[model samples]
Target: MNRTSFRGKGKRVEFPFREAFWMSLEQIRKRLKRSIILVGSIALGISLLTHLEMTNVILATYMSSMGSTMEAYQFWLIIVSLFVCGIGLINANLIAIYERYREIGTMKCLGAMDQHVMKLFLIESLIFGAVGGVLGFSFGTITAIASSSVQLGINALSFTPLEAILRYLAISTGLSVLLSVISTMYPALRAARLNPVEALRHNI
Candidate 1:
């Protein structure tokens, strides 16, 4: 949605968000090689996160819904699962930060402001994170459902599978986007702070 705003002298100005968005997409495309791993890492991390979340929900549900005794090992399972997922998230984003220093420098040298540079990377991460979330949710839900169905009837997997799936999807999506943006902040800041000339000398 485009909104009219006054900058000065009562003149209307158009914010170029659509343009900036497209440029961000273009930049992501240009760096597809670098982006692939980041996206994959995010996807893997989100998948694990979603899986862990679902396990917690479903196990609790199973206990209440089916009246099963909870096992001691399950507690350790959840902790380990979350620990592994956290590691993946850290590793992937760190690698992306390491790889993009030159790109950041180039953007800085090209008259991009600090906020603009940060915005570009933040937007890119959000896009990647969203994609990763969807993929992760799909994989996590499918596996969870499949494994659950093998132990219990498909009908008993939940009160309603679709409702549960949608809920998990929403949860995973929110978490993935949040993590992506947070992970991106330091790198974005690093990029934004680079001296343009020094950056260009090394990166460009």
Candidate 2:
């Protein structure tokens, strides 16, 4: 009896981590597949901007090389990159809003607060962004290192290696979280407004 009571006392009431984790994973998996489709479309639009950026970069490089210009085209490329990123962010969030209604509704039904549900989704997005950002950064960095090694010795890369990696990771994660928050606002608002009876009546 003492053992049983001790065990019972040791189990504390907390957020349902296991169930929530699985549910969130499913939501993310679905979102990933959908986002990829939307992103693929957006990537095509981005490619045009990228080519324009390349042209601008080449022209700016020419100008710089000839001592005729002060700023590199790369500076302007950052602006266009942000614009493309914003569009991609909007697309990703819109898709999430459309796709995750059922999951959101289920969370609401389970006595989870609307804000908590929203946070859950937001956290999911953050995790996806972090994992993807880190992996992509690592892969790209390695590829760049390898390619440069063949052409101009590994040490020829001008960046302070650790500082560059940290800067890229920080920027990537921050931008990702910003985009995720913006993308989630609409859906989060909708989830917050759900009336329990109506939420249950409709299939998400």
Candidate 3:
């Protein structure tokens, strides 16, 4: 097979799959970076929320304890922290989706099906969610295990129940999936509705 290359001032070459793949990969990378940041923000917010919930649970169990006031402050901190983080994540993904309109259009021009484009975004979200889940789960488990022995300045604490920890992990993973789905929906819809000619004309 003879492959033609445009050189010097001769002919303008047609785009090939190899070139398209690289271009798409670059676009995907850019999108992924943005998504990762969003994920970080979302996770931070969720962790805060979890922290607040956990504190409330503790306080509920120790209603007669003297440190309920301090526990309330801790609970508020966790809730507020998570709220901010969640907002950051949502905005980051939204911006990324908007920025990639051109690339989405390009893919459509090259006969990439709308469904495939949606799947591409979905796969990216799944990859991020899976990796984040594994890391967060491991870290939380380790922290819980380590907390078993630590003598807190405020109060002596027992190890977190393993079953309770696993339940938390399951819930977190479920929420991550929900967020991924919600994040992908608008972008996927836009990609599905792209006009090929305008898509190609769309600059970064």
Q: Give per-model CA RMSD.
A: 5.5, 8.0, 8.9
State the displacement of the C-alpha of residue 1, model 3, in Å, after optimal TM-score superposition: 22
Instruction: Give a tens-digit lDDT track for model 2, residues 1-204.
Output: 011111112444234445555656666575667645543433333333333333333333334553323245755765666566666666666656655565555655655666566666666656555554454445545554555446445443442245545655566556555655565567666766677666555663
By lDDT, the best candidate is 1
List the global CA lDDT of all models.
Answer: 0.66, 0.52, 0.55
Candidate 3, residue 135: the lDDT equals 50
lDDT of 2: 0.52
- Mind sharing the TM-score for model 2? 0.58
Backbone clash pairs for candidate 2 read none
lDDT of 1 by residue, 1-204 (tens): 122121323453332456667777886787787777767766776676566556555655666665333356755764565456556655665566556666656655544567776776788878987988898887876666666666566743673346667887988788777777877787777777878776656632
Model 3 sits at a Cα RMSD from the real structure of 8.9
Instruction: Report backbone clashes per prediction.
Output: 0, 0, 1
lDDT of 2 at 9: 28
Worst 10 residues of 3 by lDDT: 1-10
Report model 3's TM-score to 2 decimal places: 0.62
